[model samples]
Each structure stands twice: as C-alpha cells, then as structure tokens.
Target: MKRMKKVAALLLAVVMLASTAACSSDKSWAAKNDSLTVPIGSYIYELYAAYYSASSQTGDTAAGSASSQAAESSVLDRKIDGKDAKTWIREKALNSTKSLFVIDRKMKDLKLTLTDAEKASIKTNTDSSWANYKSTLEGYGIAESSYQLAAAEYSAKYQKVFQATYGKSGAKAVPDDELKSFFEKNYTDFSYVLCKLYKTDSSGNYSASFTDSEKKKAEAEFNDYASKISAGTMTLQQAADAYKSVDSTISVQNDTANLKTNLQGYPDDLVKLLDGMKAGETKAAEISSGYLYILATKNDIAKKTADEMKTDDGRNNLLADYKGQEFSDEISKEADSISGVTINEKAIDSYDPSMFAAEK
Candidate 1:
C-alpha cells in the first residue's frame, strides 16, 4: 500500500540523519591510536599552548590583542626559527600531542598509577584553573574536561613517567654517588656581600658615582672582611651582617646555594672566579666594571647534612638537573617508536591558532 511505503521512507530518512550525525562526531576527533582517542578539544588545547609558546619565543606581544584581525595577522605573518609561524605552531601542537599519547601508552605499559595524592592534586589544580579561566578557555571552545585532559592530567602523567624512570628505586635509577658528583661539578654554593660604589638619591635612585676615596674605602673594607672570613675569625654570614651595618648601601646575600656554573646576576668574571675557588675560600672581587665590589665565600656542598639537603628539596632540584635531559631524550625516543598514530587533518584544519589569540 502507498501508506506502508510512506512509513518506510520516513523511517529510512530518520536512520540516514542519525548516521550523518554519528559521522560528524567521528570527524571531530583530532587523533587516535588503538588504545587512545584524542578529542578535538584536546588538540585545540595543545594548539593553544603551542601558539603562546611561539608568541613568547618571538616576543610577539600583539598576538594577545582583543582584535582578532590584528592578533591573527600578527601571528600568521610571523616567522620562527626559519619556519612560518602557523606551520611551526601546527607542527608543535601535533608533536606535543603525540608526546602526550606516548606518555599515556608508556604509563599503561609500565603499570604506573597515580597516587591518591596526585589525583587530588590534579583535581585541585584543574578546578583552580577552571575557576580562574573558565570564561576565557570556554571562549576558545575548550571544555572543562579537555582542559583537564591536556593540562593537569597530562602533566601528572608525565611526572609519574619521569619518576618511574629516574626515582631512587626506579628501573633506571642513577646511583647516589653519580648524582652527587654531577651536583658538585655542575653546581655552586656561595654567599656574598655587595658594596655599591654608586650613591643613591633620597628616593633611592642611583644619583652619582662614588669619589675615588669612597671607592678605595669600600674596597679596603671588603678586603678586610674577606681576610676575616678566610682566617675563620668571622663566618660569611657574620661578615655580611657586619658589612651591612657599616655601609647601608651594601647588599648581602647569605648562603645562596645550588647556583649553576652559569650564574645569573653575577658578572661573568665573578662567576669564573667563583668556579676556580675552593670551599671555605674567601675572595674580594671587583665586578660591574669596578662599579661594585663583593666579598664572596664559597661553601662546601659535600658537607650538607641530610636535614639541610631536605631544606627546599635542593637535592631533588639537583637530581632533576642531572638527569632531566637524559630522561627527555628517552621519552622522545619512546614516543617516536609508537605506531598506529592517526591524525585527523580535517578536524585540525577546522580550527586556527588565531582563534585563541584573542584571549588574554
């Protein structure tokens, strides 16, 4: 009957509509492997991060403008490290997403599970971030779940993998002795009292250089303090305190520890001098083209007590420095070896980095 044919046609139309909707959803996935499915939103999150990272490296401050036209043009037209900015951003996002996938796969292979504390930390961090940037992130089409997936969850997984590979009881643990040797060779611990040869105005602005007599007096005082410290009559902290009392312009940094050989703030000559000095040795150095003088004393890191090493977890930082690059290289190797990764170019091309640039 005609009525029966009409009903069958209507059912077929409904089925076709359902099928199309399902296909549309599938197309929204940015990537996937046998065991992992990366949502489009997660890919967008990676793109967002890559965009900002490139912007920061190229010093493209205008990329964060409210005007989408300006921000998009600025970012799209830029070049980074000999590559087009848009291309760099896309490649970085894709590679970073693959890295995340590798991390997840490795974590599963290694039977690694985040601790309850870590889970709570991730939730707390994600919740805090969502609270602060909910509107801005949502405006970029990043859902709360995708932000959690790409940010805190991804970070926690990476940390877990790093620890499993390098922790004290890890399968590839570096021996304590080796770590210590690396620490001593690559790190420096020292304290200093700085005497500025420039005078300050009432508002504490640099006004004038010290007279030759003032410079000589400052140098003589620092040399005397260095002598006292070298003689063991005054500790470095005691000398710093005493110098500050005498010259109000003096700045004292006591027990500054774990400074790498490439020390910042201090001049290159001073860093070279510090590198060559032994523990318990005190020296007076003219830095900043003789505009300032410092009485510096190098400290022995080998003598750090267990309790002292726990202070600020200096030991952990040292371990990170010693093994961080090696661990990263290993992760990159494993990530590259992973097979069956498929990226949805259509889904990726649907979005643009400029879409995120309008966000503050």
Candidate 2:
C-alpha cells in the first residue's frame, strides 16, 4: 500500500511539472494574432532598440554604457513628451512590432521577395550583430533567431515593400518629368567659403561680436575671393585653400553638391542667395545675423540629364524630400488597420529593458 502511494505521488509530480512547462511556453509569447504568435524575445528586442533610441534622443550619456540596473532606472525615471519613459518605450516597441506585421502582410500581398543579394546582406548584418551582442541579448532572454527575425523585418521586408510601392517600376512611380521638375526647383549644387565674424570659446560656442575693423577686413577678403571665382581666375577649391591660408580660423566647405532647399546648418539668407544666383555666378553676402560672411558659387546641376536624375543619389534625394513621408504614413496606417491582434501583457510586463543593457 505504501508502494502504491509512492507511485501515485510521483505521477502527480510529473503532471504538475508538465503543467508548469506549458505555462512557461505560453508566457514565452508576447502577442498573438490568429495562428501567429509573436515571441516575447522579439518584443524584448524591439524594447531594447526603443530604449536606446529614446536615450540617444534625450541625450542620455549613460544610455549604451551604463550597467543594466542603471540603464533600466535611467529610462524608467525619465519622461518623454509628458509620457513616462517606460510606458513610452513599451508603446514604441509594440508599435514597431505592429509595423513588422504590416510589412510582412504587405510583402505577401505584393508578392515581394528579397533578392539573393539582399538576403545575404541581411544574414551578414544579423550575424555581426548577434556575435557582438549575443551575451547581453541571451541574458535578456532574446534568442538569436528572434533578433534575426526583427532585423529581417526592418532590413528586408520593409525595404521590399517600399520599393514595390515607389521604385522606378513601381505601380505608384512618379513621372520622370515631375521628379526632374521637383529636383530642379528644390535642389542646388553649390559651394561656399564662410568667414565667421563672431568669436567662439574653446568649446566652439559662438558669441555675436566682431569689431568694425574685423568685419570690414572679412568683407573685403571674401569679396575678393568671390570676384576671383566669378572671373574663373581660381577654382572653388583654390579659393578655399587661399582663404584658409590667409585666415586659418575661416570655415570653407566646397563641393557641396545637391544642396536641398532650407537644408539645416545653412543660413536662410544663404539659401535665398543661392535661389537668386545663376550657375557659375559667385556672390558675397553677410549671413547668420551678420555673424558670418560667405562667398558662394552655384554649380550647373540645376538641369541634369534624364539619366543623371535616375542615379542612385538622385533617387535617394527624391525619396527623402518627397515619397519617404508618404511611405511612412502608409505603413503607420497599415499597422493600425491590423485587427484581432492581442498583447500578452503578462509576458511583456515580466521583461525589462535593463536586462539588455550594454556591458561595461
């Protein structure tokens, strides 16, 4: 009778162990939609990315270098746009997951597949990342396969959808003449030599002060450079070299091709000047609140050949200026439209961003 009791007890223990294992398996999934189960590891990977991205945006120096506990605390203690950092990060990660789902669904709908070259690139990138962060990721309970899955979503699937929607041969390809016209109107190829009239501290913080003599000297010197460039007496590079020789503190940025309208880091006055100036014409002006004097020469790429407009660089600029926002909005809309998806809050809540903190 005692032997029978022992056997029964052992059987009960086995059943309990199996039940616990099943629960763990369920918890391993972060979300589910119909037959699809999104792994907790995948969500965790996205969370890790979102945390670091937010950290970088907020200029948190300890973001990628801090200890796991410190990293976690840093994000948790902060607020982004009036939202708690933890909540913000979690929402960002989940939204990224939804985007991945959209990418996958769109790729299927479009009958798109990654080329062999694209597949190879993804593998190479994933292998490198996995090798570098394997230990940290494993500690955070992220498997290599999960990381690869996320990487593929971003690198391959997303890009394929974008190309299918907007490539030269895509259904929604912009007309060549329209792209050319947009390029001509909004893009400029130019070079400039800037003589800053302000003083800066050791940390390069500019102070808006220049003596009358200093301003006069800068204006005269820059105007001479501009006249020489306009007369073809010196190339833009030569002028830059000459200016640097005369005033080592002067800033010269030549060969600035394909400058778009209202580009950051360029003064509004300079953009306006470029707009009015013809190709091969050189002009000197005071810009940046009269703190900078510039000698600028516009290049003759305002009217490029049709083939030139079809180059990779040209296409990229168009995407950045035109179709990129449209694509992003479309993806966001698609992600929002996905239905029957449910989050495993229990699983997600159990994970933490600090678990994948960078190793010191």
Candidate 3:
C-alpha cells in the first residue's frame, strides 16, 4: 500500500499541476472579447488543453493529436482494449472537472480556523505552493488569474465539506453500538505478504503497463505457490522465499488495519483473497498488483469493556475516522442522486480553439 501511495502522490502532483493549468486560461479568452467566457464543461476542456499545450508546445495541436492517437493505437492492434484513447482522455477530463467542482463545493462547508502564527507558518512551509501553481498554469498556456480562481473554487469546496460534516448543527451521529461492532468485525491481523508480478522486461519495475503474456506468467507462478500451500506440500513462508528467489520484481511487507474505513468499493476478489485466511495461508492467483501473493498472519486483537467502547471519548478519538468515511460515502451518493445530473456530451464535442477569435 505504501508503494501504491508513492505512485499516488506522484500522480496527484501531476494532476494538481494539470488542473491548475487548465483553470488558468481565462485571461486569454478575455483578450478576444471582454465578455467572452466558456460554459462550465467547455472551460474544463480549454483548461485541460492549455495544460497539455504547455507540456507539448508545438504551437500546433499536432502533439496533442499524436499523443492521443497512440493511446488508441493498442485498440487497432487487437490488444484487449475498449474505447478510443482520445475518448478515454476526454472522459477523464470531464470526470476531473466534476471532481474539482465537487471539491470546491465541499470546501465551502468547512472553516479553517487557524491561529495567527499558524497562518504565518503556512508561507514559510508553503512558499513555493503559489509559485508552483503559477508556473504550472503558465506552462499549460493559461492565464494566472484563471489558475487562482480555480484554487479559490477548490478551497471553497473543501470548506463546504468541513462545514457540512461538522459545522453549526454538528455531524456527530455515529452510534456507540455501531462503532463497537465495526471495530470488532474489522480488527487488524498483523498479516504480511511477499509478492512478485511479471513485467515487460527482466528489469524489476511494477508498472501499470504489462504484456498479456507477462501477466499470465506472473499469475501462473502465484497459482503454483497457492496450490502447494493448499495441498500442505509447502509452508507459506517457504513458498514466499522460493518465489522471491526466482522473481526479482517482488515486494514483501506487512499490513494491519484497526478499522476498514477505506475498504468500500474494493473489489470483492481482493477482499476474499484476504478474508477468512489464517496467518500462514497463500492465496491462489493474483487479484491485484499484477500477481498477488500473501503469507497471512493474525495480529493481537484488543478487547475493551462495553463502557470503554461506548464512551464519548472512545467514539470521538477511537472510531471517528471510520464513522467519517462511512458518512462521506453515504452523503456523496445522496448528493449525486439529488443533483439529477446528466453530462453535456455535445457541448464537449463542439469545443474548438477556432471558436475563440484572435486577440487584436
């Protein structure tokens, strides 16, 4: 998970930079006509275009066109694929726009009550934050104020989330009995795994991209290990060690969870892969992270008195995180349903740089 987190952080940085750039081109639009403005979704596309244009500035759309075409190339080659790459990128762009809008909406609910010193400390710690935003916006060929407005929008959304969850009326609704049951059912078992996955080449790098043949080979290896354990021929540790010796692209680590806060929407295959298995069981086949393998172990389960679990202190300090996550998921679904939203696909399709007349 930590390794996955490292990848996530990098992706987040890229996304933030991209988002900032996309939101920063309002001034360019303004130059053409003082009253000119893009519709909501179109603004998102223009922002995305500016960001990509900044990264690959050939002054022509040729670079963006070529890159998008390559993502589609795998489909033409008969690789197991769905959707054209350009369409995929566009969808992602739209989803991103919606997400940003959601975030800003959430922010509008929260209040960041920080002391004077803490506020000052932000500059010392985050001096480069705005500069970074500015640079990214500039690179994406967007205007500075456009990016600033995007930032403000996101900030508003976050405020809303905080306010909605814990403002005036307060969001303290998770019951004592419910929290205790959740904790008991989801105790951490100090389990560990040593895993190896197939990659394109001999060099060991776990990439999201892999050939089908390589994927099969990796799955075959994990399956053989699981079979041996199931048959009682090889111990889980022994299997882990043996697999490690053969596969250089392997990682070993321990995992423990006191509460399954973020486990929702996780593929059932993954849950079952870890479920009901004792510390020494290896799973058959890989469900995720290429080829999956686990040397399961149970951690010590803490037993607390009913009163201890039911106290206000317990709910607030102990199980607050889990409760918050549960509430977030529930509220998000409700919001989606109430919004009665359908995407404007035609608007997205009609987006063209030529629509914006040139500056005088």
Candidate 4:
C-alpha cells in the first residue's frame, strides 16, 4: 500500500507541472496576438512605426534617402534620413491624426455640436483624401494595403479628435481678429513678368527645344534688363511696364506682394529670386516650361506701436500655450486608453531598395 501511494503522488506532481506549462504557453500566445494590433491615436506615430519597421527590415536607410535626393517626387519618398523620399502616406497620416485631434478638442472646448451635414462633409473629405492618397502611393509601386493601413490609422486617430472637438460643430468660422492677424503675418510682397515666347520642344529635350540661337537672344535680353537696373536706368516696375509695350498682354507687376489666389504651381526659383533681390532688382530665371523675368518690389507693412506689438506678441504666446496644453491633455487621455501598441523592428530593418526588387 505504501508503494502504491508513492506512485500516485509522483503522478500528481507531473500533472501539476503540465498544467503550469500550458498556462504559460497560453499567456505567450495571447501577448503575441495583442502585439499585432496598431494604435489609432496618431497617424504620425503609425507612420513612424511603419518607417521604423521598413528601415529595420532592409538595413537600407537609402530607401528614405532616395526620396530626399529626388527633386520632384520627394513627395513619394519615405526616407527617415539622408537623401531618400519620405513616404507621403505616412507623413499625411500623422498630420491628419494631429489635425483631427486638435479639431476634436476645440469642439469640446467650445461646446459646439456637429450637424449631420457637417458630418457628411467630413466623411466625404476624408474619403476623397484617402482615395487620392492611395492613388498616389500606387503610382510609386507601394502596396495598396500599406496605403489603406495608413488611411485607416489616420481616420481612427482623427475620429477620436473629431468626436471631441469639431465633430459636434462641423466647421467653425474664423474670428475676425484671428483672421486679420493671420492675414497680416502671412501676407507679403511679390512681383512677376509675364512673357509670351513662341514655343518649341525638340526631341523631347526641353533644353534643346529652346534652340541655342533663341536661348542666346533671350539671354541677351535678360542681361540688358539686369544691366539697366544695375545702372539705375530703370526701376523693376519701369522695366516691366516698358517691356509690356512690346506685348500689351505681357504686362509685368513689380513690387507687389499679393498674387492671385488661383496661381498654382508657381516656380520655387521665382520665389527664391524674388526674395533674394532688392525692390529695384531684376532677375532672369529659366524654367522647364519657358523663360521667366522676375522683379523685386518693396513691401511696407504697418508696424504696431511698442505697446501694441507687445500686446499682440503676448496674446500669440498665450494662444500657443493654450493649444499646447489642450493637445497634451487630449493625447495623454487617448494614449492611456489605447488598447494596442506595436513596434515592428524586423520590418523596418528590411525597408531599403532591395524591397523594390522583383518579389522572389
């Protein structure tokens, strides 16, 4: 009977050991599943995570670097560092999340309510934006799921913000004082010359399109204008107006800050040239489309009195501080309540140019 009792006791110990091992295994499985969930509070954080995953997986920082080095398509690059293009979906996702958060919080503060129409507008805008985002990503050979994930993350994060802020009120009208201040701060002086050149593009080479002969003549004219200003023969405004006589439709507006609100795709070189020159200065810039004559004009803004300036500055500082506080409060609350947080290290390391290779 004692021997039998010893055998039974041994069996009981084994059973208990097995049960403990099973329990531990179950816990690990649960944790792994939980880690697969992504947080939905900030698209920026999601993008950062995504980029980190890609960067970690490929051991190629060049994926991101290639984007930065890209001149026109830098918009598509997802580079975290160096010369790669930063991913637009990731960046916009982060921005959308932040914007939604801010808007939602504002609604809560103002006790505003969102109407059905407003909600519809928001939904429509969101849908449109996502569609554009996906299309753009596809053009660069990025996976559709990746783009969808980005939009999803942004939607989830901003929805929470909307619920809290403008979700109730929809769109809020800008206050007069606020609008005026924004306008004044952003408004600046600008000038441009409109020219009509007989167009020609040769062998699909834009440079070659402007035959060497025509280029020489245009360059000479540009130089003549530049020399006139340097010699004080004519001001930028005078030169542009004079040139307009050659082509009545080719009027030049010099030393003006306000551009038509509809002028899209303004050349960056023009902006830079304008900013670099004095009010009376003239510069000739060559663009892919055609030759441009730009003139700089003086800008005069009304300065506030010392006291007034102080008051304005102080108000701005206070407003900024309040915004910071509100954002922190809202984000902290959501973060604490977030259910899933993940970091995909392997995916990030593998995120280099090699990923762009044909799938094996």
Candidate 5:
C-alpha cells in the first residue's frame, strides 16, 4: 500500500504540475461558463495515489469488452469493471483532486469550528508522513509550508464535513452514543489475503501479465493457498512467505479491514461476494483477471437494530470508521453534482500506471 504512495509522490511533482492540473468544471462545478475553476494544489498527491491504485487493481474491466483499447498506451491494458481505464482512473483522480477543495469550501460555507487539538494533530500527522518522503516531495518543488498546511488541515476539514451530515454537536462534534450506533449498524471486522497474481522471471520481474492461461494457473495456485489455510497447514502470513519464489507471481499480503456492507465505496462485485460469508470460509474472488483469495477470518454478521446499536458498547470504537466513510461519500456527492471536472487528458494520458508494478 505504501509502495504505490512513494511512486505517487514522484509522479505528482513531475506529471501533476499546476499547468496541467488546472482543468475546467462542468455544471455543478461551475454554474456559469468559466465561473468556477478547479486548480492543481497539494491535493494532487492524494488524487494521483488513488488513481494509480485504482487503475492497477481494476485493470481494463471497465471496458465493454476485455479487448477494448484506448489510444493512450498507459491505460490500454487496464480496466475498472469493463469501463475504460483512462475513464476510471480520471474519475478517481478527479474525486481526490476535488475532495480537499470542497471540504474547505464547505467548512467556510457552514462556518464550522475546529478544536485546537484537532488542528495540531492534523499538522503533526501530515508533517510526519511527508517527512518520510520529504526528499521526493522537495524534488517536485513542494514547499514544506504548503505540504504541512495541506496535511495539517486534513482532519479538521473532513471532520467538519462529517459533522455537518451526521448532525454533530460541538461546532460539528458527533455524540459518542450516536456515533457508536452508526458503527454498530455499519461495519464488520474481517481479515483477508489479497493475492495479486503474476508470472515472475528469474530476476523477480513480473514477466507475464494475467492472460487466459495465466488466470487459470493463478486460480489453481490460489486454490492451493486457500486449501493450506483451510487445512491449517499455513496461516495467511506463512502462506505469503511460503509461496514467495524467484519465478512466481502470486504475491500475498494479509490485511484486516472493518468493511461496510451498505456503502458503495469499493466495487459492488467485492461487496456482494462477502455478503453472508462466515468465518473459516476460504473463498476465491477474481478482480479483473487477478485473484483475491478471501480466507475470511470474520464475516458481516447482522447489523445492530436501533436499540441494539445504542447499547452495543463492544463496537463503539468503530465510530471513526463510519465517520470517515460518511465524509468521503459527502465529498463524492459534491463532485457528482458538478457536470464538468475536466482533467488534462494529454497530461493524464502520459502517466503509466505500470510504474507501480513489480520491477526487475
């Protein structure tokens, strides 16, 4: 996850420069022609990462047919549910690009207040994350003050948006009980293995992309991996370690996510696949041609009823997760209303999503 982010920082400075990042917005974005402009700012760092990740994972699934081709070679092979790769990546990029702008604008529009501590923490986290890749950032001409300011206000901005929608009390603070209730109703704690399939050469370079034959072979490999988990021969971590070889492409990572069933945050195919799945079930799901060998360590049980949610002290800690989703949806909705949010197609086209792929 952090790998793509490092690659993104390098791309944004070179590819997402202001001259290309400034694009025109359509109706909801601008009521009058040229009245509203979406400019390139520090936000591109976030958007670039999102677009890159989405494009890599989704591939060309978005195209009407698997063979659908775009002139831009960058996305010629990628998909997002059969949609065009460029189309999908651009949409994701646009959302990340517009998120901060809308959040800050709405904060002013609603006159929300941020507590002093919240302000300080945002800055602190932003500075820390930035420092990890400070050289890459500065190489791209990102000023420390600019990066810090964007990083610092991140929490405060989103908190304001979430509070507005959830109807929080203190300037926009959500009541703990109601927040807990939302959590109890929304999320399920689960862990999964994201098995990204590829064919590796001796040099550890991903040589063969997922083709029809590769997909079948990859499925077999993942099935065996799943069998190991079911038989208790290996845990997910051990499985990840067990299969890593010089010429294998089935890279594994064990991840835990408190996923939401009702939200359309990820692909619908993914959400539906997990529905009613029980713990101890090792299921395989293919996204595009690659595989997601889902060994569900937990499942989405029943959501808490109104009263049950209020009294569910066990899950109160999940409030942050629900709040975060609500905030993201709000920003997405705001972007949706805008008829036009133009990206520099030429600039966007120039980017190669494979830069994040396994290198030799």
Candidate 6:
C-alpha cells in the first residue's frame, strides 16, 4: 500500500505534466462556450506534481527516481509535438474538463440518474481510498472543498460517459464471442521484466551523451542478469526483488501487470520486439541508452476463448474505457480547435511544487 501510494503520486505528476489549468481567484477557468468550469487548484496541483517530478535529478528519492523509470511505448518529448509544452498541457486540460461537462449535460439531456450501485462509486475515494486521500491533502493544507469539487467533477463526467457509451439503464450485455473478438484485436494481457538504461528527467528528456565505457558497463551488467534468467536459475521476481535500483546496478525496477495495446507512450520498437516473442521467453533489445531484457509472461495477441472474455462484466468494463477514450478523443480534437480560453493569473501564479510532497 505504501509503495502504491508513492507510485500513484509520481504517476499523478506524470499525468499532470503530460496533460491541465484554469485561472481566477475563484480557481476556476471557463470554456468560451459556457460548457465547463475548469478547477484551478487541481490544474495547478498537476503542474507542480509534474514540475517537481521531472526536476528531480534521480528517482532515488522514494517519491521520484523509480517512479519516472517505467518503460513506455514512445519515449519521445511531447513538448515538441508541434505546440509548446504549456500550450499542450492547457489544451488537454481544457478539453478533458469540458468533455466531462459535455457528457454530464448529455446525461441530463437524456434525463438519466445513476443507479444505486453507480452512485455508490462516488464515495470510492472518499471512504478508505478517499480517507487516505483527504488525510494527505490536508497535510498539504489544501482545502477539502477544492479537491472534493475536482473529484466530483471527475466522477460526474466519468459515470455519465460510461453510462452513455456502454450502460443501457437495464440493457443486456453483448455476447461473449463478440467481446472476445473485440478483445482479441484491441487488447492484450502481458507481464514483462523491464531493464531500463536511460537517465531521463521528469519530462523524459535523455542525456546529451553516452560513453563507450558506459555502454560496455551497462551491457556487461545486463548480460550477467540475462544469463541468470536464461539459465533458469533466477526468476524475474527474484531479480526485481534483489535489485530495485538500476543506475547503481541492473535490476528489475518495472514489470507490466497489464497494458492496453492502442494506448499512447508505448515504445513502437519494444512492441515490435514483444510481438515476435512467445510467453515465458526472454528477449533483449538495445534501446536509446540501455538494453531491455524482457520476459513475456502472457502474450494475449492470439485469440482468446469465450471463457477468457468472461462475459458481461469484463466486456462492459472494457467498453466503458473504450467508449470513454473515443469520447475523450473527440472532445480533445474539439478542444484543440477552440480559441481564446481565458486563464486568471492571480489564481495559480504563486504555485510551489514542494507544498504537496507526500508524507514520508
């Protein structure tokens, strides 16, 4: 649980950097179309999270070093994707926030109220998950109302979108075969042991140079570990457990529990590497700054049985995510096209990243 919290905070920062913001003393920003009111506090919290996360030289600090070291699909800097980093962040936040409003409006337009089970979900973070969250936020002196409002906004947006896209108030779920087919092409379930070699900043920028000695040193260390795995002497779990640090030593810092194939930030080269390998096989590929020796635990690219799809619950869940993503994408495109989103300078101008550091 402690470890999960650290990972959550770090990832939250990454998500913040990768994506949000509004301005005003009220800590709100408005969409010109009167569709949404973006929360300034959450927006700034995300910015600071990303800022401190990336600014750290090493993830060695329990909060950061390891958190930033996960293997991804694309290790590219998005700030250079066309717009500047700030612009990209703002655009994504506005679109996402507005999207929730749009979805919520749709729900009302349809005159739909969530079922009992659905309403119960709003208290999810507020209870045990939220208890911990509230305690942590209070430690930072953040107003309870601020984050609460943000959570409510997220809940309303998410639930409505899920209902509209996948739920039918009382509709029967799709058949298992149909879901299996959808899962087969669009989804994959796999676990891998990643050996990352790069020293990236919070923003994912790589080092300016690498020396031959460094390359040889990295290769020699990785080879030793790879040989152990190949010889079937040391398991990936054992490897990951033995050495948690990669910079000072080669270790299993990350492994995939699951991955959505079509998701962004997955390295295309790594995907290609994993594609050819079968389950329980170990393969090595030299990445930008280091070698990645992966053990493919489950390769689900092959067709799944009707049992694997597990019928309605799993299908509905995936469908919610799928439809939510599609809706988000549509909204993001619209956000990109929108002009003149107003931000209040006073609301978040004096923000500091250190205030919200997690309790040790």
Reference-based lDDT, residue 187, model 6: 56
lDDT of 2 by residue, 1-360 (tens): 999999999999999999977776577888777656778889888998888887876667676564656765676678888898877887788887777777777777898878888888888888987898898888778898788878764767776777777777888887777777777666677777788787777777976588999889879988887888778788767777777865576555754334464545576788889889998899999998888888888877654545456688757567557677788888877776688788777788887655545545
Question: In candidate 5, what are the lDDT values of residues 292-351, reduced to their tens digit?
Answer: 334334433343334334543433334446566666776788866654444444443444
Cα deviation of 302 in candidate 5 (Å)? 12
lDDT (Cα, tens digit) per residue for candidate 6, span 97-130? 4454555565676677777765565555445445
Per-residue CA lDDT of candidate 4, range 227-257, in tens?
Answer: 7876878766676667665545555563323
lDDT score at residue 323, model 5, on the 0-100 scale: 60
Order of candidate numbers by lDDT, starting with the best: 1, 2, 5, 6, 3, 4
lDDT (Cα, 0-100) at 63 in candidate 5: 27
The model with the greater lDDT, 1 or 6, is 1
Instruction: lDDT for model 1, please.
Output: 0.79
RMSD of 2: 6.1
Q: Candidate 2's C-alpha lDDT?
A: 0.76
Candidate 1 residues lying further than 4 Å off, grouped into runs, are: 1-28, 59-81, 196-220, 246-270, 286-292, 305-315, 356-360
Q: Tens-digit lDDT track for model 1 on 1-360? A: 999999999999999999977765575588888888888888888999999898877777777776767776777778988999989998878877788789888899889988999999999999998998888778877888888888999989987887778877788887767876776666677778788888887887889999999889888988998888788788767776777765665565755444563535668777877888998899998898887888888878666534344643665666677787787777667666668898887788888877776665
What are the models' TM-scores? 0.77, 0.71, 0.41, 0.41, 0.44, 0.48
Clashes of 1: 0
* Residue 137 alpha-carbon offset, candidate 5, angstroms: 3.4
Better model by TM-score: candidate 1 vs candidate 5: 1
Better of 2 and 6 by lDDT: 2
**Top lDDT hit:** 1
Q: Candidate 2, which ten residues in sequence have the lowest lDDT sum?
A: 254-263
Writing each residue's lDDT as its tens digit, candidate 3 over 110-169 gives 443444664455444444455665554444344544544344433434434544564334
Determine which window of 10 residues in candidate 6 has minimal summed lDDT.
Answer: 69-78
